[model samples]
Target chain A: MSTSTNVRLAGLHARYQFVETVRVPIAVIGTTLFPTLSLLFFIVPQSFAQDPAAATAATAQLAVFAVMSVSLFNYGVGVAEERALPWDGYTRTLPAGPSPRLVGRLLNGLAFVILGLVPLVLLAWLLTAATLPPSRLALTAAALLAAGFPLFAIGIGIGYSMSTKAALAVAQSLLLPLAFGGGLFLPPETFPGWLNSISMWLPTRAGRDLVVTATTGVDLPGPTVFVLGGWTLLAGSLAVWAYRRDEGRRFR
Target chain B: MEILARTVQATRCYGPVIALDGVSLDVPAGQLLGLLGPNGAGKTTLLQLLPGLRRPTSGTVELFGGYPRDAARRRRLGCTPQETGLPPTLRVHEVVEFVAGHFADPVPTPELLEQFGLTGLERRQSGGLSGGQKRRLTVAVAFVGRPDLVLLDEPTTGLDVEARHALWDAVRRYHQGGGTVVLTSHYLEEVEALAERVVVIDQGRVRADGTLADVRSLVPARRVRLRAPDLPELAGVERSNRDGDRHELWTADSDALVRQLVTMGIPFRDLEVATASLEEAFLALTAPGTQTVALIDGELAR
Candidate 1:
């Protein structure tokens, strides 16, 4: 848990320590979202323009999907590929072992968290007819980051547990369901009773709740933030375990 | 340091196949140990235990007086593993710098380049170099931190006679600097040049450990090839070959055996004594446990 040993960090010495991982994958997530979200907002708007409220909600739904695409899908693939590189092999052999190594990765993850959120914020601003309160925008970003942290951990775990192909599949399959149940796409009040009740504990629900509260001055109870933080912590631990497991088994 | 880089005891079984059967040996620091086993003889597996790259299913491996955890310990060790790997796009200076960054007092780049004959190639990328040049570059990195101990498993994998001789000089310089070198190679000459002491490991067990002359003393000295008009059958000899009137006798000591043959009035055409080489002596030491008796007869059977 505390990787404070003085093992040297070898092979991959990055110039920008905080943003190394973000440097590559953020471009991947950002570019992928640009075209997809752009098409949804510019092209599909004609279909739902008659109902402005529906259009607004649909645009909001698209932004949530973009978050899912990058955080869970692209981030998982990036982390897995990094592990498989021989550069990582050289890094481990260094005298100052895993201590400096994990620090680099953790710092990089937080940077990506910021990189991943920026585009979604800009898209949210562009898609809304009447700007949601600035306070709402700020809350939405914070909530997305809080919610995404655990999913990033879970994504990293999946990346290690499965082959590259399998990790990608798991990421994509879980994205829609996670977003839908979290109350990002449609209000949880409109969901079936049992589904709405269960959604309260899910990361997506807490994330959407935080965002809604920030935007509309509608706060979900403070307990919701704790549940979301708990998810992130649990997933973070699992990711570390998954990484060690996969590396130990791969001898060649 | 008198510390064991790795020690394996009774380690065995690779899935259902047995790799090391009660194989126990200590790798003392500060000397080159030759892992002298034929293909599938488990030499690679034995070295893998040192860096904590592979775990023995039943034994222990210690590096610098502690259990090996990962490559970090190996980073402190210089192992020219069977595979001398480097990225294609990496320039020679980059490779040196990369490993240098991991250490506190890395060997000076210009000094190492000049010593290893890599001065001009410092600007060149590793992938574009010849096989021998690549091996040289890899060795340069191995000694980057002037590691606690250097383990060279098949060190000169790609060099010719000239380059190998150059490498031997570099190895000697490393030792002269008070650093220890552990070298292993199929080229007995390289082993002869690098290893101050030798340990022959066959089938994951140490068959012999001592100086080259000391181990050579364990096996026979000279092999006698002869042609005689009247050949009295030699008794107690392991093998005798006959072609037409020529009789070639393979024996442990050529001087004593040849004197006896001459005294017997065995008038022959020709007789010559061939001095025992390291390969010859190694075969004899590892011969008994060998499932194939090929090394026993030397080239006679083949």
Candidate 2:
């Protein structure tokens, strides 16, 4: 196939995957609802809700958590469940190679992340003291998307390496701890000295810091960009390794 | 004749178990070949090798003059595994369209659905369809790409009698259009109905390969049924089963056995001589201690 056709096929795959996920909207609803509910119940009634800077930072953290949850459950558990089906096996045998399917899956994950952010962003804007200039809002959205790579890669790694049940358990076990340790639910300033130091190196914290910097123009104390870049590289490599291992074991 | 697929001394092992054991075979173009084997006989393994879904532990598998693993070569091939699960939420037509988009020249969705008797169910979700409908759709999807070679692994395994016949007609139409088909089934009658050439595999090895009649003759038995008064003890009868007043005798040569009865002036009524069915031939050929028997041109060559 020509390069253009390959791209078009990938687009078609993405469309089909999007439609398939939307047809059963429960999973999407749950993933989107959790973070929005957290913002409504936890952040909206607090004193932070009256301060623009504090509320913006908190909203940014929750936004990162939302994307992280979507990536972990959607890609990690979703891909594992797909692998258990015969349709996945049939699709793998097609001559289209893995690019189209992988790209399509990534697009699907991005869609869920965006869908998940809608309600949270609305709550932050209407009820809390969160504020962002339109340009910074766009930039923050872009930065959060970029920051999603490592989370997406981790999800893929877990998905390809484990069964659906195992992936779900592992993803859940990792998500909350990463969020808590990364100061997503609690501000890093209040964390114990050791946790505050350790959170700087965590991908979740790096992502939250990057989003906060983008949205509120905050200066991060740590090398946030470098930390995010390094985690992306590590998680990306792990994802590729897991995919190859799965292909070897199942297809060969 | 063009050779679409060939396996040369190919053996596939799943850890300690051998699924295909050094089996060499050829699938010529424009022929419908049936691969008959009992359960755990490696029929699925053999089909999987042809589509490059699984690689042989040793030797090679070639398709369309290239390696089966080649993507370009695979473009000309289509296959349905023993079990297929369609995307549950998508309508039947949508599934067909999605699969069709992958090929350069695909049959239109409406026409393909009609061919498989799925026209009325086009709007229905695949998950909501009956098992027989799902099976029909699965088989139909294989032909949507208009592939040069189609591999169907037990295509009508769970279909009712009428549905099985419908599928047979569709397969026949495809074959008549000069498409090459390699289908696997444990049903002896299915092979007998659809195949001009039969390859019988058992215990991960090809036990017999020949035309349908050639494989049937390998059994060395004929069924002779008759009703007679005061039947005599016959030396030529290998075994006899009595149902009602009729005696069914298994013999090497029914003609000779009948001649002996006539020469003895025995009065027999309602005499019938029937050749062994493919089921009997399959059993006799795949029986223990038979080893690998390859019949070339109606003669046992190996």
Candidate 3:
């Protein structure tokens, strides 16, 4: 097939997969509601809402949390479950090759990540004094999406390497630690010295720092970009290795 | 005839278990070949190799004069694995259209569905279909691309009699249009009904391969029964057993055995001669050891 045809097929795959995921109401609700409910129950009731800087930063942290959750769950758990299906195996044998499906899955992940942010963004805007200039907000959104790459890679790695049940457990176990350690729930200003030093190296922390800086004009540490880039490179490599290993194990 | 696909001394192993052992076969274009085998006969393994779903442990498998794994070579091929689950949420037509999008030229969705008796089920989710309905749809999806060759692994497994015939007719239509097909089935009747040529596999080896009558003729041993008080030694009698006054004998030449009985003047009455059915032939060919298989091969060689 020509390049244009392949691209069109990839788009079709993405649209169908997205439709499949959304038809199951629980999947959509589970992905979007968890983070939005967190904001409603925790941040809106707190006295810190009166402070614009703290509230804005808090909202930014939660927004990053939403994106991370969607990326991890949608790719890690989603891919693992799909891999177990015979239909998936059949699709892998098609002449169109894996690139179209891979492209489609990535696009689907991005769509869910954005979907997960909608509720959180609406609640944050309505309930708190948290605010950002439209241009800054757009920059922050771009930064958040960019920062999601490493997490998406990690999710793909988990999805490809483990069985569905194991992937679910791993994704769940990784979520809270990464969130807390990255100062998503509580800003890095409050962590003890050792924890703060360790947080600087984590992908989540790197992503959170970069997005927060983009949103609030906070000065980012010198190593944030490098840390994010390194994780993306490492995780991307792991994902590829896992995918090939899976193909070898199942098909060869 | 041109060969569309072939495996030269292909061997496949799942860890220590040899699923297919030193097996070689050629699939010619536009032939509807039935793969008849008991469970664990490596039938599924052979089908998987053709579509590049699994590579042989050793030896070469070629499709369209290229490696089976090559995407370009698979363009003309369609396949349905033994069992598959469709996405629960997608309507039947949606699934067909999604697969059709991959091909340059595809059968129209409505036409394909109608051919498979899935016309009214177009808007229904696959998860809502009955077992037979789901099976029909699974098979129907393979033809959506209008592929030149289709590998169907037990395509009508869970269907009722009516549904199975529907699927068979659909397959026949494809074959009549010059499409090549290789299907595996536990139903001898199915093979007898649809296949022009049959290949019987057992214990990871090809036990028999020929036209329907040729395979049935592999075990030419006939069963002869008679009532007699005394019997003379007979030529061409493979084995003999006595049950009271009634003697039973197995021989390759029932006519010669009968002649010997009459000439010997053994006071025999109520004599009966019966040829083996295809089922019996299959069992004889696939029997536990290499004895029957070796005999058949020797006969074929002669």
Candidate 4:
């Protein structure tokens, strides 16, 4: 009826979705574990950890990767699985409209992204010479979260357009390439000539450069903000298109 | 009576398959209407149109005298589709409460659960509940918003007899309290039990629509059951099916058949003549080439 009530209902939906996923625990553990383990085993004991700037940059890059992975899997695979259920149909027909449900899902994705970062951040602090000032740490968190927008949009688009099995495979296939090609797994400085040039325009690369800049004071050589913003706009449009396509096919 | 929902020559197509073909109907306020049809008889499709879950390919569907797609109008409508899967991880109470939150004034969650006989399972996860319990919960959630109109698509489909009766009782209570309900079921007995008004649908068309008695009168055939050592061909018997040694004959005039049997002095024993049940009436009405359109027109004229 009222806008306040609608907002409250959205909050309730978010809480319900969050609780539903948290109860399973395995999904959360699985998404967050890989990045944390990668940091611990691969980056911590290496000579890179001895270099403060390199370790800090690597830590920030992995943290962004963790957020991207959670967003893609949680939104993409989760939405596809939900669409297959009758409960989703019931909710869609409710008079509350799609805003509350979409907002609730985004909130759930945000919660997982934050949860996914905790382990990585803790390992980076305890095991490596990586360091960030309190201000830079806060800025880096904001930048990493901002970087998740495109990933979330992409995930939602995939979820709406594909079946659960297809969404899972597609998200996985897209995740590794984006991470590697965007210079998340390796520093962009070490990337070969072609990849290094291509990585500057990729969303994942834009996200990593934004986070790295925020944390390490590295001046971005390319238009990092424009690249990230462009991807966000494109992915957002794709997400909206996918949702309408699904609704048209299923409900109309 | 005020009409709560109406469909005028509505037709729906799913790819090449026609689900609801030129079906016209009206649901009055406070009327418990039963849609009786076999599986894939377009009952679910019609129900979905009323709640704005699906749009018609042609013609129009209206709720509260407005387009069914209007969200403001749909706020007063509630529906349960044929298959509902609850989120497995949430406890039953949480699910109920979450759905209830969407309404302006929702019934208390515990009271609604009690009404549906789900009080004891409030703490259990929905996935852990039995199929019957889940069905009951699904039906109960449809009433949480205290909607003026509720559409239930095969609410007791997978429930046991006891569960079905419980759901019927709950539905009867709601109807008595002045709630309008339109439910679909393949079970003729269910419609006879719960609906004051019955609509029989077949091949995506309304073959019969009227009060139960009115529908029954459309097919006036009486069933005659008898056993004999040897049987001769009967002239008036329209159709007959054998069950063991007894033969069940459907005839338009049972009295004439009985009188003829007496006059002919046929050696027949254990003779029985009875009015057709709703199931038989439905079969006769839906039987191919039975002039269903004429029968429906005749009923509407009265």
Candidate 5:
């Protein structure tokens, strides 16, 4: 008789197979097409640069794609689709332990961290003025991760909580505004007093400022880390809470 | 085959609609025990609980000797739920191999494909398979572990009679091999053919638990069929509208009834008797408004 084991080997097989299946779509939507779309964030922002300070605001606005990929599409849609597959029901029935099922699959969340950065890194390098010096590029990448934390946490969190349609709704509603508010497309400096104050702590704003500060050797350290760190922790905590509190039902 | 699959006061709720109430049952090894219940009668919930696909809201469920969720406990168990949703994109072999990898020693993909009558269809994607093929595939997966205990929900659901009977042969062989099976289905024929014992539930509670004979005994087993001289209406006899001058009556004492018919020499062309099968008893046990006990002890069933 064939024997049984509780190891989560099925989960690993599934993840690899999933990646292979989606590799083409991922290339088309995430790589080839995303760069072209990334260029479109600047369509309405040239005029914002009419004011000198708005240059910083415009940088923030342009960086929106990176954060969206990391936080929303990566965690949200990716996770929800996997959850929707009947294979998930298979996972539930398998002798595999939950820890094993959980570990190998969540790597896709980290993959989003990369998808989130591609455009912004591309955007930063395209503009010589915005490029981080080679000596500081590693730190900038680190800053991007820190900045993307809240968004990443929020992405996977909402992905777990909402159904496929609801996740799409949330991703659509939150994407542009998070970018707009964080100054990924526009300069936070040009915001009204209160709005600028709020932007100082927003994830997109913190990411843009940190990247910019790292590039130009600016003294924006103190508040930049705080804003990014705070959002990361808050979102992470919420995401974990949502995950733990889940009813464990395998449905929308 | 019987199994020792047991639950202790297990209860579950899907956001307030109670799925399983306080339920407890023990099925022995090497016998096929059927859970006969109508929809929403908590059969699925009970199966899900035993397989650890769900946690009991208020109590514990045990598979074999340990907690249901324990990996070791699950390793020896096989489960097939009613909704046999196979991955549409996976080729049949990929599905088997994937599940096989989780087991310490899984059935060979080729052997399984052959065993399930999918010999050359291993490359076929699950979505493209017919309904009967899908059920066969599900059966193969559940047996992947070569488990000692198998929980089958609606086992013969989509199979034709020939296919169902063939599957029954496999189940009987499994039992002969000293494995246990617990099944739940609406097809009483499947249950009668395979199950050595049947557990009937209604509205989240087990209404009856015993061998088919014990269940048949709950309601009389005898069904009187005889040729009467004329259409003499007898009390307790159900009218047969067929062109024959025969009548039928359901009862427990077939010999006594037959003797009475003969001793009286009642004007009848022919007379005979038979006991009720498990179906009538099951129907009576689960019928609405008749209070039946739950968590029965063996001695009490007699």
Candidate 6:
């Protein structure tokens, strides 16, 4: 097939997948609402809402949580559930190959991630002291996209390697710990010295720091980029390996 | 005849258990071939090989004169695995269209669904369809791309009588259009009704492969039922069962058995002689310890 035909087909597949996912309202509602609710109940009622710097940093941290939660559940639990379906196996046998489906799924997840950010952005702008210049706002958008890569990879890795039941448990269990340890739930400055040192290396911490610096004009530390890059490489490798293992286990 | 797919000495082993052992077969274009086998007789394994879903352990499988694993080569091939699921949330038409998008020239979505008896169900969610409807849809999806060859494994497994006939008509129409089909079924009547050629597989090997008549003749054991009391031993009778005063005898030579009964002055009435159905022929061919043989030119040989 020609390259253009392949691209068009991928676009079609992505649209259908997006429609299928959103038709189940709970999936969209849960992913988009949780982070926005956190910002409303916790950050909006606190003293941080009056401090421009603290409010912006807090919103960026919550944005990291929003992006990570959606990426984890959508790729991790979603993929594992699909692997058990007969339709998924049938599509693999088609001559068009796996690219269309993979690309479509990734694009669908991207749409939801963007949808999730909307409410949080609006709430922060209205009720809190979270303010960003046009340039800084653009930078934060780019930074959030960059941080999503490792989380997406980790979701895919867990999804392909585990059964549907196990993936649900793993994704759910991993979510809170990663969020808390990476200082997404509370400020990293409050951590004990050793905990503070350990939190900086977590992918969530790396993602949080990157987004916070982008939104608040803080200087990004030297290790932040390396930490996110390292996690991306490691998680990407795991995703690929898990996918291959799944294929071999089923079709071999 | 042009061969669309072929496997040469293809064998597949799942760990220590052998699912197929050194099986070789060729699929000719424009022919409807039926694979008949008991459960666990490797029928599914053989179909899986043709579609490149699984690789043979020690042999080669080819589709459209190329490696079966090549994605481009499968463009002309369509297959419905034994079990499949349709995305629950998508409408029936949407599911069909999504698959049709992958092909260079696909049959229109409306026409394909109508052919499969799913016309009015365009808006129905696949998950909400009845079992029979789901089965028909699965089979219909195979014809969407107008493939030259279609592989169906137990295509009518869960359909009611009416639904089965509908599917049969669809398959017949496809075959009449010069499409090649290779289907496996436990239903002897289904094979008899559809296949131009039959292959009986058992214990991971082919015990018979030929025209229906050729296979029936391989085990020419006719069933002879008669109401006879106190009948003497007959020379040509292979096996005999008695229920009250009725006796059912199976023999290769019913003519000789009847002559012996008459000549011995045995009083027999209500005699019934029935030819073997494909089910009996299938059972005789696949019976355990029966040496494997191929029928060539209406003659059986090892």
Q: For residues A1-252, what per-residue lDDT tens digits would candidate 3 score against the true structure?
A: 678867897898899999899999999888878878888888899998767777788888887787778777999999999998888888866787778889999999888877878888788889988878888977897889778988988899999999999999999999999999988888889899999999999998999888888877989889999999999999989999999999899989
Model 1 error, position A20 (Å): 9.4
Question: Higher-TM-score candidate among 1 and 3?
Answer: 3
Which residue pairs does candidate 6 place in steric collision? none
Global fold similarity of model 1 (TM-score): 0.73
Off by over 4 Å in 4: B81-84, B228-247, B250-260, B294-302
Tens digit of lDDT per residue, candidate 6, span B118-228?
999999988788888888888888888899999998999888898898899999999999999999987888888899888888888888888888877765568889997
* Deviation of model 6 at B87, angstroms: 1.6
Leading candidate by TM-score: 6
The sequence of per-residue lDDT tens digits that candidate 6 reaches over residues A203-236 is 9999999999999889998899999999999999
What is candidate 6's CA lDDT for residue A242?
A: 95
lDDT of 2 by residue, A1-252 (tens): 577777877887888888787888798787888899989888998987989999999999999999899889999999999898888878755657678888889888888888888889998999999998888977897889877889999999999999999999999999999999988888788898999889999999999988999999988656888999999999999999999999899878
User: What's the TM-score of every candidate structure?
Assistant: 0.73, 0.93, 0.91, 0.93, 0.79, 0.94
RMSD of 2: 3.0
Q: Once superposed on the true structure, which residue ranges of model 6 sit more than 4 Å away at CA?
A: B81-84, B227-247, B250-271, B294-299
DockQ values, each candidate: 0.23, 0.57, 0.65, 0.64, 0.28, 0.61
TM-score of 2: 0.93
Better candidate by DockQ, 3 or 6 = 3
Considering DockQ, which of the candidate structures 4 and 6 is the better prediction for this target? 4
Poorest stretch of ten by lDDT in candidate 3 chain A: A89-98
lDDT of 2 by residue, B148-174 (tens): 999988888889999999999999999
Once fitted onto the true fold, the runs of candidate 3 whose alpha carbons sit more than 4 angstroms away are B81-84, B221-275, B291-299
TM-score of 6: 0.94
Summarize candidate 5's per-residue lDDT along B1-302 as a digit string, tens digits. 34467887877778878877888888677877888888899998888788777788887777877776667677877766233467666788877777777677787899877777878988887778999888888887888888888888787787998888777887888889988888888888778888888788878877878787666566655777777766444444432334466676676566666666667768776666666677766766776876756325333441
How much lDDT does candidate 6 score? 0.87
Report the Cα interface RMSD of each model, rounded to 1 decimal.
5.3, 1.9, 1.7, 1.9, 4.8, 1.9
Tell me candidate 3's interface RMSD.
Answer: 1.7
Clashes of each: 11, 0, 0, 0, 32, 0
Each model's TM-score for chain A is 0.68, 0.96, 0.95, 0.95, 0.73, 0.96
